[model samples]
Target chain A: MDHQEIIPNLFRTEYRKIVSVLSKRFGFEQIEIAEDIASETFLTAAQTWGLGRIPENPTAWLYHVAKNKAKNHLQRNALFEGKIAPEIKSATSDLYDGDIDLSPENINDSQLQMMFAICHPSISQEAQIGLSLRILCGFGIEEIAAAFLSNKETINKRLFRAKEKLREERIEIAFPEPAKIEERLSTVLTTIYLLFNEGYYSVSQNKTLRKDLCLEAMRLCVMLVENKSTGTPQANALLSLMCFHSSRFEAREDKNGELVLYDEQDTNLWNADLISKGGYFLNCAARGDQLSRYHLEAAIAYWHTQKADAKEKWENILQLYNRLLQIEYSPIAALNRTYALSRANGKEEAIVEAEKLKLEDHHFYFALLGELYTDIDNQKAAQFFERAISMARTQGDKQTLQRKIDKFRPADIPD
Target chain B: MDQYLLLMRLDIITKEAQPSPEQLQVYMKQYHEWVAGIAAENKFVSGTALSTEGRVLQSDKVPIDGPFAEIKESIAGFITIRAESFDDAAKIGADCPILNGEGNSVEVRKITSVNENG
Candidate 1:
């Protein structure tokens, strides 16, 4: 078997199991050593497995190697201190009693515990996500540093210090208590969601979609859904929301790598399988009537995916946005809802609703407002487009707004 | 071929300066162990430990007791190593035992063998 294709997933899952077990056995301070040993194990397998047929059970083969690497690491440390444990020597010499718990359920539980530990709110949100990507997702410090546009040394220092703090505090590798689980779950879900978004809309020059991140997020959410103790209505809602959005992944971008907006996208290119799965998750999310923001967002996305024409879907989207505003009152939601209203009720009603939102500092809000006013033949609203052009961060966004401004002729200006 | 110095600077100011005699002995042992380790690894070159006392030689060949300038990073020690390139020298310098203690530093430099005698 081509181990390269399977190694990353195996490494992520197996490494977490090994680290969690070793951290419990030798204390959290030794987690770095565990990670190093785990890395060496994969390196060994990458070198060794290619020369011969892959083992009968690749996971078992990896675990055996990792366990031995861990033992060797401990023994080397002991030898460096001029002391060696006889039991460790015996265990290394005889691999009979070193059976690792490689069960899928056990592995998932360990990974979930590790995720919780990394996302502990006592740590900064930046540190939490950085550590989670490192420990749970198996992202390297250099990869994460690049993502945050920082140096690798800074990322390494942050991870080192964060782990030290967790060890000092004796942070246990277990799920958060029930009362605090809901609050903690939101942060974890947001991290995973953002990870998927980064993969979906990659900032890197190489490729747009980082399939690894998207798959990892989905796998983690699957773990959440399977666990009876932690699975909640919001978890299902977020997972469904991700699935609905990801269903359009195949059609989101064209052959030349240009983004195709949802209205212009080829619906035939959408993954029907993913759409069905998303629908299933949406139904699961409906079991609880608390109505999360994700639930409303998923409902809106489902409506868009189901509709054949943009004109038929605007009213439902507006209603979903109204419900979303009632649950989570945000300026972005109001701006979005108003845009939908513009398509449903005439430009005048949309502009009236949009004016109520004081979002002068937001560039896209001004751009949307300008577009709405321009549709109503109000050339005076070019000022908002000019403001948007000045505030725009990306060249593409700036160009788009400038084009809107160019369409407003001075001769047709309203005083 | 042109040559450049690969220097490793370390800060030595903090609350842990005034160590007990026993602690100083342990620190010395650790340092020596590190030095031996580097030597065994064949990366060690010429270097020395400096005392806290400040000394100077005047132009007239007279010894002078000097407080020196109020500098934060006083030269603790240094080492010389031969390499085909500056990168190689820097890699060798990275293993220097002088960096074992907290806030200690090891600076490396290339000796400019200019024909000043001519």
Candidate 2:
């Protein structure tokens, strides 16, 4: 990459490393301080590198500057805690690398610890995801706002309050105790799942890609799977499910950037490599008898990649969704299961179950009803599609509903 | 070749107005491109960046970190470049990214040699 792109990319990649390592060293209470030092180091780079004087070793230069800045900060702020982390304090100027080890393992370890801290249940879920995006993912405030579909001021205030809460609670950045690791990992996985879902499903366009959010979630999940202590079967299942979804991410959007229904999507666009990776993680997850919502969801997603409209695939998907609902009773999950029922059984049985859902406010409900009644009752399908069109929040969904409505009355509708 | 000094005075960023890391990266890219453009023309000489935490020494009073009580901007840094005239240096200064900020300015002056080596 050219120098123009280098620092920004580095900021994306190394900013988290430096910030996490610093937070890990000093704890969350000093996180804002750590961020200040990291930001200053990059600012110095921005100005110095502007003169076409990029240092021979850029990473080392960052380390050197960060080391100096940390020392300078500690000196200026006499109100700092009486004891400083010894590792950073005693290092000589030339031996700055000794101060903060930016080794790959260290970086991962620190980020993992931070993930757990940021996802702590003490804070609100929105704050947890916001902090994760900002502190662990190196996302800017504006980027976080785009991901959340909120403005910068709201995101900034949310983060500021979250940081204050962490400080107030004296939250530690160390990994959870051995006994609590499983419990803690559950919350972390949920945040990861939510993050992935936001990226995979959000309709907010123009700034941050929904694809990036899913990829970031997968990256975090990989960290959990790589570490022996945290890599539970559920984590593997979650990763597998994400891989399957991401494999078809491109297929979900057409050239004109319109949403494609799953059944109508061109199978040729599916990524074979990600599909196989998803299968690999599923195999890893099979090592344990402990089933999770993720395992069932992974199985459902696996069937989706088969790309066949066969009864066998639909039957297996129905079974997995069946098991999924028993464990988790989400209205969306039930709605999905009803669709599987349509494919597995027939439209009549699916329509009965879907109508019972009474999800009047959800556009997807009307959209699904429209699909079910298409073959059984064309007039009802058009009415349901019309209802969906008015209620759908995204233009993509509204257009898709209109297309469904158009299918019934080609003569009456204009092109 | 005549040497011209570009003295930069920039507005200080308070805590409330601190630029985000992403914003810093964006600014850095622009500045890097500008410097590279000058270097490509073979007019770039050398430059230095000043730390905000600086002390001003005076004979009568203890050193202070400031431009002055009345001044709202401080010397940010400077760069020297080969130029034919003051106007030529001004041409380069016109696009200096630092000047993007309010109250920021680049004062272009010719660097005159005072004495020859004995």
RMSD of each: 24.1, 30.3
Instruction: Tell me the spans in candidate 2 whose CA falls farther than 4 Å from its real position.
Output: A75-97, A410-415, B1-118
Candidate 1 lDDT by residue in tens digits, B1-117: 223343434334334565678977986786667567656756555556655556666689777664232554566555554455676666666665546656656555666742111
Q: What fraction of the true interface contacts does model 2 reproduce?
A: 0.00
Q: For residues A1-415, write the lDDT of model 2, one tens digit per residue.
A: 5557778888887788889988877668899989988999899988888888778888878877776887566555533664546665653444434656667788899999999999999898889989999888888998888878899999999999999988898889989999999899999999999999989888777423688788889999999999999999989999999999999988888888888989788899999999999999999988756888999899999999996679999999999888888778888898899999999999999998998899998888988998899868788788888888889998988998888776776643333
Question: How displaced is residue A190 in candidate 2, in Å?
Answer: 0.3
lDDT agreement with native, every candidate: 0.71, 0.85
In Å, residue A127's CA in model 2 sits off its true spot by 1.0
Q: For model 1, which pairs clash?
A: none
The TM-score measured for candidate 1 stands at 0.68
